[model samples]
Target: IELAEVVREVTKAENKPFKPMYDWGDRVEDKIFSVANKIYGAEAVDYTATAKKDLARIYELGFDKLPVCIAKTHKSLSDNPHLLGRPKDFLVTVREIIINSGAGFLVPLTGDIIRMPGLPAVPRATVIDIDDDGNIVGLE
Candidate 1:
């Protein structure tokens, strides 16, 4: 609820239209690269060629107005995951943009992002167990 209010405030403050999804289209990659370069001195590589065919196919199907969801490491604003904790001196290299037409978002592949979420070293499921009385236990 707080997030929703914040979004409302931000939208009103910015005076931007509240679109369900934002579509930057072909210029999305360049725009992001420019911003990164300005802010962090990072360089974004263009690997759109690899996904060119797929993107073209998506466009052919007429789903070109979808907003891009950039897939990058949360560890750093830059693409490099190892460069954690707001390091400013690094290049952000974008390898490709994977299109999810059905989901209506373009995933910009940056650095070494593992698309799959990995399990913790000690998974909680392992620690979770049931008591002899059938009550749930070990779920702190």
Candidate 2:
């Protein structure tokens, strides 16, 4: 669904509109959702019927305070970046689900993706340095 639509639903449920946020390349982690919205043509997509119904039920069960976890690929919006823009007949294979009691939420792992990512072979830290005085410097 469109980002605006998702925000609207959340607002209707929570009684307030959630602020919009976007992250460009600087923060790779935060931009995936925006990319999804762009790829899916905003408002053209929706969560799986089963997932949506489950979320609604959870909300009805006095779980408004609980967290919402979006299960998606850690890769590009197309699930496979090689194929861009709203892909049809694509299948998201969810391997497992985990519940975080402390966090009061459910995690639906949709694919083999890493939450904690490791740097590439040439680490950015290689060029970073901290002096004895605590001053820091890195690639410009």
Candidate 3:
């Protein structure tokens, strides 16, 4: 998607105006990449490799077979961590799986999931201080 955006920008600057190039069609890849960027660096290791390591580690712990719980964004293949800024392409892959008995769900520890959350402009915290004389004052 970033590549496509670049192509579009280049075309516009050159007075060509290309429709834009998309591998998976539309801007899905771009959106996914954006999310991953927010969670991890653009050059972070592949998710598949991470997943495989997790599976091996879990198996070594004496856990039997379990369901697979993908931690990536269900909306897209990539995780959602980056903000609105453009993101680079980072391939994602799965490695292993484990069952979470406590939660009654399969915990498939994938490479990683970068979750960038939205915050309120105004924080909901107030600071107050009191002196030995019992004089209270507001803190900023």
Candidate 4:
């Protein structure tokens, strides 16, 4: 039943149009800020000012045409992960955009993305054990 539900969700998503968070524009910074204002009623600031010299150095090396990876919370469309289930009347605050020219992507630090995957309240490792007969036990 769980597998069926998962398949159903995958099918639904597959049929949906690919709507990007930010639209394409002459400047990536402008596009991001505009999209943020339109959708989340907030501003997207370019926190990359500190790395201006480094960025200029990279640009001079000629690796500017790379895709961006916006690092946002998967739990919610808004920056606040606590706002669940298609929340309305909310704002998304974009703090920074980190450019990884070598990796070929700009990581936009929106809200907070969990860089590390966390263990559940009661981790399965606690329950999972090897039986005396050498069979795995305690997993549904």
Model 2: CA > 4 A from native: 1-68, 117-140
Candidate 3 local lDDT, 1-140, one digit each (tens): 99999988987889854442323232322433333455533544343655556546655754433333346644444444333244456545444444565664344433455445556686534446787999876655
Stretch of 10 with least lDDT, candidate 1: 20-29
Task: Please estimate how well model 3 matches the true structure, expressed as its whole-model Cα lDDT.
Answer: 0.48
Could you estimate the TM-score for every candidate?
0.51, 0.34, 0.30, 0.44
Stronger candidate by TM-score (1 vs 3): 1
Winner on lDDT (2 vs 3):
2
List the global CA lDDT of all models. Answer: 0.66, 0.49, 0.48, 0.62
The candidate scoring highest on TM-score is 1
Global Cα RMSD, each model: 7.0, 13.2, 13.4, 9.0
Candidate 2 clashes between residue pairs 3 or more apart in a chain or in different chains: 1-45, 2-43
lDDT of 4 by residue, 1-140 (tens): 99999999998989988776554422555555555566555534444454355445535665444455557788776677888876665655556656676677765677756555657999898999999999999899
| Clashing residue pairs, backbone N/CA/C < 3 A, model 1 | none
**What pairs collide in candidate 3?**
35-81, 38-81, 38-82, 39-81, 48-93, 51-95, 51-96, 52-95
User: Which segments of model 4 are wrong by more than 4 Å?
Assistant: 1-25, 34-65, 116-140
Model 4 scores a C-alpha lDDT of: 0.62
